[model samples]
Target: MTQEDKINWLKENEPILWANTFKIAKGELSDKQTMFCCCGKLATGLHEDNCRKFLQQVKNETAKRLQEYIK
Candidate 1:
């Protein structure tokens, strides 16, 4: 997806993630699922998934910004 689309998608999905993250932080959930909630890797596979998604977003947005600059 385009950077803008991806960014908007993130923004929209952030609330759900944020709430879940809070629960994780409060010990209501496992760290494995919410480890990446604060930008750190979780012990579970979920952290890996979040890491990949975060990296993809960063990469896409960086490329998009670069392209805009080149223009």
Candidate 2:
């Protein structure tokens, strides 16, 4: 697949995550919204790269949140 096809596939398959790229790149996410995105993606089985990256981006301050979910 070409780069363009890969881009289109992401947009089509991960619309929510694709739309979030702009906000994520800008580092505009609050702790609450970051938590929401992580949980929502896992609970819904979205599991896109954005979700993993976003979780890692916020991981330091979000250990408590992860603890709650894991326990």
**In model 2, what are the clashing residue pairs, if there are any?**
none
lDDT of 2 by residue, 26-58 (tens): 254442454356445542224433565554544
CA error at residue 40 for candidate 1, angstroms: 12
Clash counts per candidate, in order, are 0, 0
Indicate the worst ten consecutive residues by lDDT in candidate 2.
62-71
Deviating ranges (above 4 Å) for candidate 2: 26-71
Name the best candidate (by lDDT).
1
State the lDDT at 14 in candidate 2.
60
Clash pairs, candidate 1, are none
- Please, what is the TM-score per model? 0.28, 0.32
